[model samples]
Target: MKIEIPYGDSSETVELADRNVEGVLYPNPVRSGDEQQVLRKAIENPINSPKLEEFLNGKKRILLIVNDATRPTPTARIMEIIYPLLKGKDFKILIATGAHRAPTEEEYDFIFGRLYQEIRDRIVVHDAKKSECISIGKTRHGTEMRLNKLVIESDAIIPIGSVEPHYFAGYTGGRKSFLPGVASYDTITANHRLAISQDAQALRLKGNPVAEEMEDAEALFLKLNIFSIMTVLDSNHKTYAAAAGNLRDSFQALIKKADEVFCVPIKRQAEIVVTVATEPTDIDLYQSQKALDNGKYALKDGGIIILVSACRSGIGSQTFLDLLGSEKSCKAVIEKLNREYKLGYHKAGKMAEIGLRSQMWAVTPLDPETIRKAHMRPFRSVSEALAEAFKEKGPDAKVIFIMDGGLTIPRLT
Candidate 1:
């Protein structure tokens, strides 16, 4: 059988014998339709809140929060529907960059698409390190809640982003657009410290301390008419479903649709797991780490993980790279992380944790030295990596291929 795995702008096909393949994971089938129409309808009819027009009554100076380039949210389509409705009102779009670097002009053009020309002047890139953030108090979890000053000064704040399974914080969208999206560096680090807990794992929400703390942090701004629009995309990255309304309630509605589209069941664990970081997620090492974390769920102890990511932009964040290169051993990294938790550094810790349990080989555009620094062996081709893994584990080793590693969560049945 030939499996086409996502790699950068295109895909690469790897041929494997049928008997050697254990399973190929994919999101459940979803009805295909006009993506724009779905988004428009979702905006007109919100989940549990008033319509956009009704919600904007007598309100001015709207602050719109959008996910940055690393995320796959359809910002252009969303703005096309929202911009005209708030014609006379004062509104501006803020790119929620979190601690990641600001998007370049070309990247912004790509993110906004055709709408770039119309709303380019009104867009503001959030700087987490800037003094423009204002403290609104702290969450019950003791996270200092400092957000973009615009959020506090604006008459209304609307967060827009895609909903997907997150390694921590349960899922993306909703309160996430605030906590780490447009929040200050201190606020981001403080809230991200909760990631060390097991409850912060993907697809879990009920007792997720990270998600709960984020909700509590966002609740601090509820008085400012904070409505949200969250979207869920199909495997092709097209809009599958969307929900709009009160941040938490609307996000809850989107989560149900997201779960149906992203969760996959597996018969058992595999000794060798191969996965790809598909499109937007494959842009850099910082974002691509999610694939390794998710794939770990389907891998047995002492197994090998062959992750295919383009990492065209190299390691996305300097802080992450520094953390990974700082520690000489996985044990030392874990010890440092336990003593002091940093936002981007946690990603390094996670990679180390996975590395300690199982071996990982990555096929990417990154240099071998950089890949080695992250504790992952680098390969120029997936076939070569797989061949070596098979040789090490014997020819009859059980293997599984995940088409979209960053999005699909495999559950053992």
Candidate 2:
């Protein structure tokens, strides 16, 4: 059988004998209707909160927080319904860049689409390092709750994002737009440290320390009228479902929908796993790591995992690359990460953890020298990587191919 996996802007196909293939994991097929219609209906009927006009009627200054370009949320489409309603009201759009670098003009244009020029003047790109952030309070975990002053001062706070399976923090959306999205570097790093905990795994929410702390941080802003508009995207990147209202309630609604769309059950683990970081995720290494983490679940211990990502933006962040380069071994990386947790560096540590358990090979645009520095074997093509893996495990090795690996969570059943 020949299967096509996402690579860079396009896709690449690989041929594997039927006897050698274990199974292919992908999201369940779902019908989302027309994109604009789905969004319109969601806005017209919000969950656990008043209608849009009722919610925004008396507010003087409204602040809209959006996930940065790294995320695949269709912000501009959501804005079409929102921007018109706040025509006369004072509102500002803040990009929740987290600790990553600010988005470029091209990225902003891509994010906003046709509306870029229309609301360009109202947009404010958040700088986690230099931005003026106000400390609200500390969480039970002792994470200093600091956020952008605009978020604190706004009469109304509306965060827009998509809910998906996150490597840690259970899932993305909900309170994430606040912590890592708009929070200070100190707060983001502190909160992200909880990722090392066992509870913080993908498709998990209950008892996840990282997620619990994020919820606690949101509680600090009880006095503020904060509403969230979260969406669920299908494998094709179209809006599958949307929920708007109280942060917790709306987020929970999206989670229920996501579970049905993204969770794939496998009969058993495979000896070799091949996965792809699709589309926007393939744009950089930082975002592409999710594919590796998710694919790990479907691989047997000591097995080889081959990941295909374009990584067109190179290493994505210097901090992540530096952290990977700093340690000589996986143990050394874990020790350094635990001793002093840095924001972007945790990704490197997580990658090292996975690399320690199983051999990892990458087919990406990243330079071979940089790939070696990160302690990963680099390959020029998917076929090249698979050839080596097959040579090591034999031609008839059980294999599994994961499409849109970053978004699909595989479970052994």
Instruction: State which candidate has the highest TM-score.
Output: 2
Our tally of clashes for model 2 stands at 0
lDDT of 2 at 253: 86
List the candidates' TM-scores in order: 0.96, 0.97
Give a tens-digit lDDT track for model 2, residues 1-413: 99787787677788889998998888878988899888888878888888888899899889999988888899989988888888888999999989877888988987898999978899998888899999999999988999999998998889999998899988999888998899998888888888887688888878999888988887887767887899999887889998888888888888889988899889999889998888677768888888999999999998998888988788787787788889887778888887876778768878888878898788898889888777788998887788889999998899888888889898888
- Residue 124 Cα positional deviation in candidate 1, in Å, after optimal superposition: 0.6
Cα deviation at 96, candidate 1, in Å, is 0.8
| Candidate 2 RMSD to the real structure | 1.4
Residue-level lDDT tens digits of model 1 in 1-413 = 89887788877778889988999988777995798889988888887788888888888788889988888899888888887887778889899998888888878876888988878888899999984998888888887898899988898888999999999888998888887988899888888787877677899877988888987876786766777899998888889998888888878888888988888889988889998898778879999999998999989999999889998788887777777778887778778888876678778877888888899899998889998888888999888898999999889988989888999899887
lDDT of each: 0.86, 0.86
Give the clash count for model 1. 0
Task: Report lDDT (Cα) of residue 274, candidate 1.
Answer: 92
Q: What is the C-alpha RMSD of each candidate to the true structure, in Å?
A: 1.5, 1.4
